[model samples]
Target: MAQRDYAMSGADARRAVETGLAAAEWYHTDIPRKEMKALMARADQPAIRDTGLLFGCMALFAGLGIALWPSWGSAPFWLAYGVLYGSAMDSRWHECGHGTAFRTRWMNDWLYQIASFCMVRNPVQWRWSHARHHTDTIIVGRDPEIQAMRPPALGRIALNFLGLLDAWQGWTKMLRNAAGRLDPDEADYVPEHEAPRLIRVARIWVAIYAATIALALATSSLLPLMVIGLPRLYGAWHHVMTGLLQHAGLADNVTDHRLNTRTVYMNPVSRFIYWNMNYHIEHHMFPMVPFHALPRLHDRIRADLPAPSPSILAAYREVLPILWRQLRNEEHFLTRALPPTARPYRAELHRHAPGVPAE
Candidate 1:
């Protein structure tokens, strides 16, 4: 079996383009144009309500954490605060990046910038990166965001729960970008014209971080960091947990999202934190649909797609075994069985690595 090369400049990436997996037309469940338009319509109310509540709760938590600091009573408040800072900001950044979070364009841009800062993502760089993600998701060498590669490094996944790897890499990238350097992969996708804006944002972030660290030094207390820098590390678990389910153990280089993405049913709290991204297939199929509208879109399209995993736990159950098997057979992945009401997989376009046996 061939070991998967996930580099943008690797042989597998060349194969992906040659095999028509790069920028190829993907299968989206047929939805009437009128209904899709309704679903895609932008609205500010839902996002406004959610954003207010999210930040409101974060404020309450952060205040309590500060008041009760130097006491173990502050522990829970800090923990709650971290998830909002570390995890929830991720989805906020994501939705706002798509420009569907608010009916007003400026609202979306404002939130995208704030959330991008909290998450250490260069707004200009990630905006283009995410566009590429939608264009060629899970296509090795083309998609920059394939988190779980073949022969999954379970250790790396574990470390990321504490934001040890991803956040640190993000900070390093910010520093490099601050120095006006674009790594090869970033340069490939990010527009040359946007480099200045990306660099400017990175420098601003570096300044903010340096100030935050300097404040900690001046205060002789870790308090400032707990609110700013520390939460990203301490509260990274929830996002890491949910993020891995997006494409881990799914077929790569497939034109169909059902073949690459998994949607799991989650509770209200998780839904709120995730911004309804649990409706993964629907979101991918119709990227224009707002996060608030994903559930309705999912309802309209689920019949044409594989059934969603019943819950987050169930999805991990389904994915973990396949990842374990892929340790030996890199081609190994779960070909999710579609319900009878769903259309069949586009087997013709399901490009597997050469020499891999079809199930």
Candidate 2:
């Protein structure tokens, strides 16, 4: 189907359900390696420049300046780090996830491991989970990254602690996946060849962490390990907040492709800094396109998308009505968007539950 045609029928909630369910069954029951290979290849393009790197570095420098400059010492360095330096780091990792950090694949992996180590994130776990997110956007029981539960204790524990814990949990998840504890279908994005590299990169990350701590203890009087080191955790929290706010509660229910992700209004500055990731829907549809190309793709397809929720601000407001509900109970947010053909549809009854109404 044309991307445009996909967008139209895709706007109907029921159409989304049918389409996603069908695709999931096909992909899961009889994996179409050839077709998938072809599909993924079609979207593959050369690595693009990361314009965000300079800005990210600047943000990091600015935050550090605020923290260390004598006159600026009490300037709430963590806040500056969170809103600015943190998102800057996110942009870096975001590009790394796409394998766009450098020309060689190995080079890119190393860059991500080093940069991610400094940022206190695990590139291997992030790459795996993020790739899975692309493969299964918003498909409940499928997308491990999707905000699956309400009262978000899981998200809170996993995501809130400056992504250190989130990254840590991701590593733990990766270990289980490697051990064959997780279903192959649910394994997300690990590949046989990538395993060795991930293990090595993980070891490098451990060494970097230890060296950083040891250096902090030996060199600085202020316990640089605790003070400066904690900023990366602050950065992780910023990542979690912005990331969750961007996509968490947009849909009435999880379905697939179109309804699962939403676009937000972004100012030019943000567009430049965030590298156009705010065009969430288009990126989901065209996952292989690098961050730099997203704006062009979005422009080409703008008229085809469901009208954007009035503005990013308005869109955020729209999610609020459901946020507390989601926080109160998972069921409230666990519904799926339905396909047009399936309307006259009843709320999806959980196969596991009998005589129970869908929330």
Candidate 3:
């Protein structure tokens, strides 16, 4: 099969969409999203192994503290530890949710569960929502993940600035809403499966996470109790803020394969923080493509993707201007869409690495 060619620029992105959407089989294909992801090249072994160990260590020690000695300090180190581990765990969960962390499906689920210990958010729940994200990312009204912050307009800026705090508050509010207390319709979560066994697992997920919270309240001091809240906020905002720089308000409102994903020109600092997720367009086009593999993929396929609008760091800086425009209601978000390409972009893989062609 000939490689698909891509034209660079927001204009080319749009064309890719028209081409894809025009295809008769697109809507009817039975290819599962998971299989599509796995078809990408394998992830880098070193990065995957190292990250797993690091997060694993953090989770282990934190769990020990939470269980054995809940009051070693007045400030609640366990709480702080929980937050840090929670954030890192969520990162692992994100990777595992894609089934890229480990080769075995059951192993990935177990790893995801460990990460979920502090988080308590059921891995299954996230998997279902996330699968939808991969399928209909960035589509307005259709993609459940894409939505304006409440109160809309000016409130969006305020919400982003409040950053982590807003995320923490939202989580708390979600717990409240789940109990029929508050209404955060924007969160938009739906049950994943209805099988009795699945429901039983979901109940266990709820129980374990709730037990962690209960343990904190019973054993830790007031200061420690506050620490538990910090992880939820930090992880939520860290993920969102990074994503905002990644593709938020950057792509056109369309949901085609290429246009839905984006790349952010990034600096070394941001790169480390984002774990190479900055090459989001590459990731989306090839979801199974691991973080470490993105650079290689980019070098191969750069000509096909939209030319770097701004480096990731530059993109973050530019977001303020975009936010201002959004605040003024000029645009809901600052997203770019590509125009059509004359031909699909292909890389000469064997030229550089033995089998890896430049796309």
In terms of TM-score, which candidate is strongest? 1
Winning candidate number (lDDT):
1
TM-score versus the correct structure, for each prediction: 0.97, 0.65, 0.63
Report the C-alpha lDDT of model 3 over 275-332, residue by residue, as the tens digit.
Answer: 6777877776667766666787776666555665477556666555555554444234
Q: In model 3, what lDDT does residue 153 have?
A: 48
Q: How many clashing residue pairs, candidate 2?
A: 11
Clash count per candidate: 0, 11, 33
Against the reference, the lDDT scores of all candidates come to 0.88, 0.51, 0.50
Q: Write the per-residue lDDT of candidate 1 for residues 1-359, one digit (tens) a residue.
A: 56778888889889888977899899878878899899999999999999999999999999999999979999999999999999999999999999999999999999999899887778999999899899999888899888898889888989999999989999999999999899999998998999999999999999998999999999998999999988999998988899899989888877889888988999999898899998988888888999999999888877888788899999888888877877777777777788999888866866463324324
Sort by TM-score, best first. 1, 2, 3
RMSD of each: 1.5, 9.4, 10.7
> How much is 288 displaced in model 3, in angstroms?
2.4
Give residue 341's error in model 1 in angstroms.
1.2
lDDT of 1 at 167: 90
- Identify the superior model by TM-score, candidate 1 or candidate 3: 1
